[model samples]
Target chain A: MLELLVSGFAAIFTDPLAISMVFLGVMVGIIFGALPGLTTVAGLSMFLPVTYVMVSHVGLSMLTAIYIGGTSGGLISAILLNMPGTPASIATTFDGAPMAKKGEAGKALGIAVFASLVGTLVGVGVMIFASPVLARLTLKFGPWEYFTVTFFALTLIASLTGKSVIKGLLSALFGMMFATIGLSPVDGTPRYTFGSLQLTSGFHLLVVLVGLYAIREVLLTASSKQEPIKVLKYKMKGLGFGLHDMAGNWINLIRSSLVGLGIGILPGIGGSTSNIIAYSVAKNSSKHPEKYGTGIPDGIIASEASNNGSIGGAMIPLLTLGIPGDGATAILLGGFMLHGMQPGPLLFQQNGDVVYSIFAAMVLGIIFMAVLMWSGMRMFVQVLKVPNHILIPLIVVLCSIGAYALGNRVFDMWGLLLFGFVGLMMAKFKIPAPPFILGFILEYQLELNLRRGLEYSNGNFWDVFTRPISGTFLALTILSMVVTIINNHKASVRELKEKKEGTA
Target chain B: MNSDTKREVQIGIFFLVLATAYIIGTFGISTFTPFGNRGLDSRSIPQLIGLLVIILSIAHIAQVLLREKQVKALLENEQEADTLVCDEDEVACIQPVKGTIIERLDRVFSIKLLLSFVYLTLYIAAYQPVGFIISSTGFLIAESLLLVKKEERKRWRTFIILFSIGASVLIYFIFTRYLTLFLPSGILG
Candidate 1:
């Protein structure tokens, strides 16, 4: 292990192209992430197709760099424009926007950059050391264990249910139904084809993503009479923070980063939730909690660090267990398959150098993100000055092109339009789209594991509960759902009390 | 036509109809299956989903009804408060009456919906015969022209068209050459 680490460091230093690709990837990722409506997933997806032409190690390096950089770059717009460049940065706006208003935009950005670097390093350290052990443990998991893990992931929809649990579950069920449109996974029997040749191929994932997030946002923004709100014009002054400030918040930064890494290692829990969790933890622990949302550097640091840290944390499962942590990692998994490399317990044994190269690239990417964000803050801020009418139309065109480009099929363009309309209707009805996305991604695994587990158990239902790992995971799933319900109920009661008090 | 009430009614009706249609569709599709399987078959999942949708729709209708009752109760309490005091007509009359159902329906079918219908129709019509590049460019140009603020519309028209055309062409080349993806040429092929 020591030798592998040493050789990995040496390989990265020796390969000039690897270093350059990492730098380039970070730059592209920052640009994409700093632009609202262009998420880390889109950036990774757009760049993923390019990996087909490159060597596996170099390609993986580039993808990792983009993932790391994109997660960190979101803070730029959140601080400068009060618009979250990515959903993960939503909590950053609470303090980042205020800090910008108070003319401490530079300090806020500096803190975000430094914290991101620290978080990413911590996450990478954990991943590099812990992935092998996790992979070995995962090797013991049987079909029942796989099914239970997937079931646990699907139950995360409860956490995302904003106000209506039934509506959220319905949305997830709808997604699962959509997944059943194509041929049956186990039997190859055609289902829900509706007599169209295109239906046989199933709905494209890219179309669903673009429609559910990008196109829907575009149409909603276009329909509304309200113009985009510009918060403050940001000015860059210092790129450095004092040691006193860093030392003062060191514990908070470490704690938040650990929280981020833990959450990211869990399938289906993405950087967005990590950001919110980190922000809440920081606020709860702060002596001056009231100053958090009023614009404090600590809030900015906590959110940015946690989200960036998620990049490395998410990679752990993807590289070692063949299970993606979130949508972006799922796409990365696709890229790995495209390169004829299967990512599972066997991956390290088959391609140790490739794994080491990815680690090296991630470290380099973190440094690149800090440097590029500090220097390129002005460029990202300028992007916010563009008028919405012009900006939205451009996004629409890009989305159309991206959808069409996926399969080079005109049918996919139609698919994009169809999903866009569905997305618009969903927005009108206030149904969240993430659960749908999660369901779609998990459908194949869920079905496959269930069938395999049943077959393995000879149709005995007790097998699912009898297995220790499956039972434990099932218990945890139930616990999580109960906790979510209690939390929501408490929040609603408090809200109702406050409302009544105000009325009286 | 109170907008909120109309919206709720329309949604309720749509879900009810959808549930019915899905059930019928699943049953019809299942009947056509050649093989007789007692176990989980192609039709099972869809049928299950359809049933779940029906149950959920019924629950939604009930919730909507309960919400309407609560809202009416609140409104009645407010009205009673108003009746207890002799209010000045000038200040009291400033509050607008809730819109009628017909007015809400009209709003639902306003110019925006008409424009969206037109846009989609134009897209489908132009997609095949005009090819991907030409149709997409045209769509972008027209959409931009329609969306531009009135004062800046004329000045930006030329720039918008040129930019749209450039973008379309660039995307065409990248997708075709680099990615090995094809776009529809329609009659232009």
Candidate 2:
């Protein structure tokens, strides 16, 4: 691993282009992340087609760099504007807003940045060790196991994303249905092509991503017509607080990082939930629990740390099993597949160098993220002032360029517009998009394995229940759905009771 | 139904139509069973998916209808049905088109949204035929102007124009030159 790391660093630094790409990616990522409404997923997806012409390792490394930078950059707005620049920073506002209100904005920003650095380091560190081990374990997984695991992941995402599991199910089904449009798995037969050759190739992930995120975001902004938020004044002198401020918070930081990592490893939830979960955990354990929301560094640390830690946690499953935990990792997964690399157990043997280089890039990227963010804090603040009107249209054009470049044809660009509309409708209806995206991503794998498993069992589906691993996973899928439904029922019943009592 | 429930029902019905179309479309998917067809063929999964979607959509619509009924019952007990005023801003509250073209267009998407979509369509249509430089320049300027507030248009116009053309040319060169990615020059070439 150490030797691979050295070689990976050597590969990047020796090639000036690759180094610059990483730097550029990090900068763009930070800009995207620090902007309200633009997200890490949006940054990665918008930038995806640009990397298509580059070397495999270089492109992947650049994408990872973006991932790292975007995750860390959310704290800038969370601290300054009291609005989370990305969903990952939602929990940061609890303490971050208060901290800034109390004239401790600099301290809050510094602590958040430092905490992000630590969280990323810890997350990436674990990913380096855990990925290969998990990859090896996955070598034992057969068709049944793979099928059941995919099913479980789908359900987990369905249950966890947004509200309404039923809507989640519909969304996933919709995505899967869309995925089935291009071609049938296994037999290589075309399904639902409707005679257009482009339809046979179906929609590229690039088209879906750009259309859904970039185009949808533009239309939503245009439609809602929100005036851009003004950047607030904040005083900053140094790293805000010294080592003494961090002295008493070592355990909280580690615990929050772990919480982030664990949630990140789970399908469906990522930085969005992780930061909040970590914050709550930190608060519950703190001696002065009431001090959590009252401008404490501890709350900021927990929120920032866990979300960053989730970057690593999210990567583990993605690199190892090819299952993305959330939207950001899903885009990363698309990047991998775009490079013609299927990230699975055999990836270690076939593309170990590229994988290690990504790991190296991430480690380096985190350092760059922390350094550039603090040093260029004033610039990011200016970035926040870039109005949504100009920013939205500009990003749309950029994204359109990306979509057009997908096949060097106009068809994919049209696909981008189509999905953009779908994305808009999905948002309007409050349907969870993450599940649909994950479902779209996993559809091929799911269908392939299911068919293969059926073949292996000679069309007897009951055999899946006999294998311990597959059976356990299937059981867990059922259990998770049942539990979610029951819990939702209980909550609604309690709410109804409260409403009835109030009326009386 | 209230707007929210109406929205849910619309989505549910849309999915139902989608599922029906998909299931119908599956018949056109010719079967190819390689290696003696011991298990399910290519058509099986699509069919399964179609069936599953049908079930899910039914359940969704049913759930929405049930909830709407519950809400209606509660609302009726709370107050008379005559007091239920539909907000004009609510999408479901839009009556069937009955007036001028602008008023008719209001039944669908907003005029701004319609114009933006038209711009997007024109931009995409022009992307290949008219080339990257002309197409992108036009797209960026029109889109930016449309999206920016009307009051600020005069101030932003020059900067928008310069940036649009410059960005288009720069991007064309950068992609074609440094990145080695193709960008059509068309008449500009």
How do all models score by TM-score?
0.84, 0.95
- Candidate 1 per-residue lDDT over residues B1-189, each given as its tens digit: 234444545555666676677667666454333333323445665677678767876776676677566555545444322212111111111122358765543344333333543564476467767887888787777767766677888999888889888977887677668756566676567
lDDT of 2 by residue, B79-112 (tens): 5333222223232124554699887675565666
Instruction: Give the poorly placed runs of model 2, Cα more than 4 Å off.
Output: B72-76, B80-111
CA deviation > 4 Å runs, candidate 1:
A1-21, A42-64, A224-238, A265-269, A316-327, A330-359, A387-391, B1-39, B55-76, B79-128, B184-189
| Lowest summed lDDT window (length 10), candidate 2 chain A | A223-232
Q: Say what the RMSD of model 1 is.
A: 5.8
The lDDT values for all models are 0.72, 0.84
TM-score of chain B of each: 0.70, 0.83
Model 1 chain B lowest lDDT segment of ten: B85-94
DockQ class, candidate 2: medium
Clashing pairs in 1: B1-B100, B1-B101
**Which window of ten consecutive residues has the lowest lDDT sum in model 2 chain B?**
B83-92
